[model samples]
Target: MIPPAVLRRLNSLTGRSAPITLHGTVTPRMTVLASVSLATFLVAGMAATQFRSQPLPPSNRLARDEALRKSVNQLEDQNRALKTRVQTLQADVKAGEDESARRSGAAQEVKAQLDEQKTFAGLTALHGPGLTVLLHDGTDPNSSVDKSLGWTIHYQDLQDIVNVLWASGAEAIAVNGQRIVPSTAFHYAGVNILVNNASRLSGPYTVIALGDPPALAGGVGNPDQLAELKSRNRIYGLGFSWLRSTRLSVPVYDATFLVKYAQPLG
Candidate 1:
């Protein structure tokens, strides 16, 4: 159907009784457009009413900013107080540590002195000009025919020799390159001599001692140890030889010991 505006123009031009349906001259496209416009207006009115439902006071930017600033300042004051407390605690701890450090330093110095004395007492390894004593088995390749006569030096020989050397001016001693303290031991494991329960030693057994050569030589001049030594040499034909050297190295004691009954004496 034609629109009313177009029908009116036609009536003015040709003078017909409006060539449109009695219902009106609304076209299908025009009717759709009018329905969409009416729906849009109703939706817009509903949205405006919903927005105006909750009317608000005017914006107060300055008041909100002032409140935020107050909150920030309060938080900063709390943070500052906590930081000050932490600093004070740190200072107190530092003062206590400084006082304790003085005593700790003194204790460390004492320990260093004690360790040096122990090292000098042959509790640690040392190297210097000293002497070496070689104790060999009496293995005469040309004349040994008796099987009962064991031509080897026993542990007793080794102990006696060490005692004699220590009684002399020998400062330090080692058997088979093993350091000897008062706790050192020598025993027979089958046919081999075990030193310090760690190393198996065989002849010729080497005994190294560190001391002043002149003092050691003069002090070890007793012939009683010599007679016992000679008797063994005559009976078993054991070999004994000693030499003073300008250089010798004594090793550290590597054996472990457990002391269940002893405590440190003040």
Candidate 2:
């Protein structure tokens, strides 16, 4: 049995107040064994507590993954929509370009037509191969051959020659540097013969026509075309000559339009 004083002292040191009873004889060895046994139990219990598994808190991983999936889907949808919009814009741009090209082509065609009209209206200068007809007064001053006007170049002679040139498909004609248009007038003005009513043509009038050189020359020199002129040239020594040229140029008509009441005939 342990002494009461010793047991109380042991209780005071260990801070224990419960009653301690031993069945064996109280000995130092027994006390030591009891202390070691209590220590081992406390150590084992602490170790068990330290290594014990605990339930984990609820996980948000599944929710986070779902949110990420939704975000990626939204981004994909936006990308697809952008692609569609881009394709539509590209088609529209292509259509616009095509329309612009078509308008440009039409504008070019219209410009070409206007230029052709201007050329045909004698508003533009012309240059090509053709013939030059020269007419002058006759040298013979005989009273019988002259008949007061037979020896001199007249407006009728000019009119006849111009008609022949026209029949020969002359593209352009000029008299003494004056362009002959559809409105040109060939008539007598006092003692001098007037051409285009703007120029008084003197002797040796030069008439230039733009056409096939050989054709124009042949048309002017044809006896059938100028039968009366040929007879007069033989009878009264009237001067008439025609020559072919590789290059010829006709000036643009400089006179103003004077047809006030007259509309286009054809």
Candidate 3:
């Protein structure tokens, strides 16, 4: 044990402001216990800090996953709607194309019909293999074959021949370069033979036909069909001749038709 005087002297030598006072005598066992308590305090502080910085709980994570799933569903629904819109647009486009094609086809059909009507009306010139008939006054004009001028070619004879040609499938006919149509007339104006109302025809008349060669020739030369003409041709030598041709053309009907008493049927 140090004396009071010695303690004061030690404190003065160590540069202490006050003298050290030992409340109780310190032992090695007590020093060791103080150090272990300080270590335990430091470890508990570090564990609390780590817990504060941990990940979110399971409930919070589940809510976030559900929000993401809803977003995906909305996007899928929008995708389906967009696909349907695209299909609708495509169908409309296809329908428009079909309608355009149908209109084009209808126009083409009408134009085809107009062209056929023009052909039938003799407004268009025709060319094909056919025959040409020639008719003139009978020979031996003073022979008095029947005294009724039966040897001469008349307007009635022309009409008969025209009818026969029509019946024989003549697609087109022209008498003296005049196209014969449905409205054509074969009659006599006084002594002169009038054709188509304005045109006059004389002896050696020419009849141009466009059709099958053998068929036209056969129909015209049929002995039973043209019996009277054949008889006149044999007896009085009336000029009745036909020639086949590989290529023949009929002129377009240039005469204007006067629709005085005619009307459309339908």
Candidate 4:
């Protein structure tokens, strides 16, 4: 029922061939849509897989918390042990110090006891009022008179003076700065008089006897006996003197004794 021209135009439009499309070819818009859809799907799948693979938050959190608690407990135990060890060390140190102090005290006490014994033995230097006696040789004016008289200080003379001093209650006695002890001995070595095992004496011999000055003087008593001894000295041209002093200072002897033949008394 349409006009011929109109119909022919409609036929032309309908008969026009669609653009020849190459296999596997796509339009720009279609390619873009497909890429977007593929990207979306891939991203969604990856998200789902990640969700399934991941550990639960609470489970991870609890594991970490437990590990931390265990570490804290271990640390606390270690700290306690260390504290105990330190305390033990401190106690040991204190004990050692106490022991050291005790030993030091004992040593001091022993030293004090030894000092006391020495004082009691009259093996000490004496000061204060005392008397000094001198002995001289009679022969050479510097030596004893008769060669047969054994021209040096004799053991017998020393014995006599020591006995007299002891009888006089002398507190201390020294000969040439040598303290006299109960063990002290006088012996003759040839012509020389050996006192305390050493024999080298020269006049004037000095005997420091500590006692009451008056008592010491009285103890020496016989001036005639001394005079006769002096006469013997005159034959040798030797001289002697007796001096009484109120403030005499005698030095203590610090001699080391070596006992070979005697045993110590307990």
Candidate 5:
């Protein structure tokens, strides 16, 4: 319906007014979004690498646990050894105490036996009816003197009296308070009579003999030794007396003598 030139110009206007379409290439906004996405991905990867390189706390914790376990094992072993040692020491102490008690009991038994033996042997003092004989030195003025006689009171006179008293079954005897035992000795030392290793026996030498007075009196009556003792007493101014009493006490004698051959055997 229009002219050719007009139609051409109307078509041109219509084409200009219509929207254009791109079919072969991407847009600038799409490229920019892709680049941004790639950069974000690289940053995330770098952060993961740093985290992997750092040390973990659990590794140190495991090592500390292992060390603690070793220390506990050492402590347990030490405790076991100490327990064993304590047991050994306890046993030793008990054994020592037992041995001590045994020794103490043995010592007490021995002491009791010794005491009993001493009692049975009559090793203690005794007091009963007895006889006493008195003798004096011839040189003393307190003695009786007969100028016509000759002999002096010698050591033999005292020895004879002691022998007669023993023969009369005297239980205990003492001369001048010197107790007569089986080991008692009489000897002369420098013109003096020594009894039991002692001297200076002078006037009023009282000999205590513990026994039945009647038996002792019968043993000494009218004996030859008595006649000789009387003769000496009259001749050389010696003194003599004999008496009987109801009670006279004799003391115990304790003596310790060394033995050369004594030794301890294993």
Candidate 6:
């Protein structure tokens, strides 16, 4: 309880620099109540701010978790499918290799059979140690054809020489690069003789026989063979040369012969 004149003097000294100007004296109880109310409001505001920044609700959280789980499951399924496809491709590769191996083996077997057939059929050329028979005309080109007294080699004389060589165990025979086979035959059209009906070997014929060289040459030394050759030598004036060699090549048979009287054995 201050006097009015004293209070006016105190206000005059303060000079209007205060937040609130009190006309009455301050009370302890009122001040305490005001502080408590202000503290409670600040605390409530802080709680509201914290609540606004909190995590999402249970429904939204569950939805996010379900979506992530489904994505993971889809990735796992895709990985499994890729693994299955890889395994299938590996199996296919292995199968292809096996089939190629089978085909390769079959091709080799067929080639072997074909080689054997060619050898047996005399379609393939042969080379071995044997004898060579060379026959030449006795009449030179300077001599007249009629006056030379038919001094030329005949196909019959060549046939006799081949028969003698065959009896001497000649494995293969060729006359003037002409391969002789079981179906071979000679044709005489005047002075020119066609061997095997496929080729016409001129004068100075080369008869190659593949076998034991000594045996084949000695075969021409037989009495009947020598007589057959000598008897023709007087009339035709033909020259014969029997030679033994370490290597002789017999040409391949080119003419095709179909046997109507024979069948293949199983």
Best by lDDT: 3
What TM-score does candidate 5 get on C-alpha atoms?
0.46
The lDDT, on a scale of 0 to 1, for candidate 4 is 0.70
Q: Estimate the TM-score of every prediction.
A: 0.53, 0.68, 0.63, 0.47, 0.46, 0.52
Indicate the worst ten consecutive residues by lDDT in candidate 6.
1-10
Per residue, candidate 5 scores C-alpha lDDT tens digits across 1-266 of 22344434444544666433335566787656745664575567669878999997768889999999999999999999999999999999999999999999999999899876653344677789989887776663443654532344566777888788888878888777767776566776665677766445653578888999988776666555578787766766677778889999776654433348878898
lDDT tens digits, residue span 34-135, model 6: 456645755676698799999967798799999999999999999999999999999999999999999999999999999878865678999989998888
Better of 2 and 3 by TM-score: 2
Maximum-TM-score candidate: 2
Candidate 4 residues 1-266, lDDT tens each?
A: 22344434444544755432235667787766755665576567679888999886767889999999999999999999999999999999999999999999999999999987877565555578889888766553333443455445666777777777777777788777777777678777765666666544445578888788778777776564445454555555554567889877666655546578989689
Q: lDDT values of the candidates?
A: 0.76, 0.83, 0.84, 0.70, 0.71, 0.78
Error of 5 at 252 (Å): 2.1
User: Where does candidate 5 stray beyond 4 Å?
Assistant: 1-122, 139-152, 198-200, 254-266
Local accuracy of candidate 3 as per-residue lDDT tens digits, 140-186: 66754557776788898888888888989999999889899999998
Ranking by lDDT: 3, 2, 6, 1, 5, 4
Q: What C-alpha lDDT, on a 0 to 100 scale, does residue 262 get in candidate 6?
A: 93
Two-way TM-score contest, 2 vs 4, winner: 2
Which runs of model 3 end up more than 4 angstroms from their true locations?
A: 1-93, 143-147
* Model 6 Cα shift for residue 45 (angstroms): 8.2
Displacement of residue 247 (Cα, Å) in model 2 is 1.5
TM-score of 4: 0.47
Task: Tell me the lDDT of model 3 at 141.
Answer: 60
After superposing candidate 4, which stretches have Cα over 4 Å from the reference? 1-116, 140-147, 150-152, 223-238, 258-266
Off by over 4 Å in 6: 1-42, 45-81, 119-131, 137-157, 160-172, 209-238, 242-266
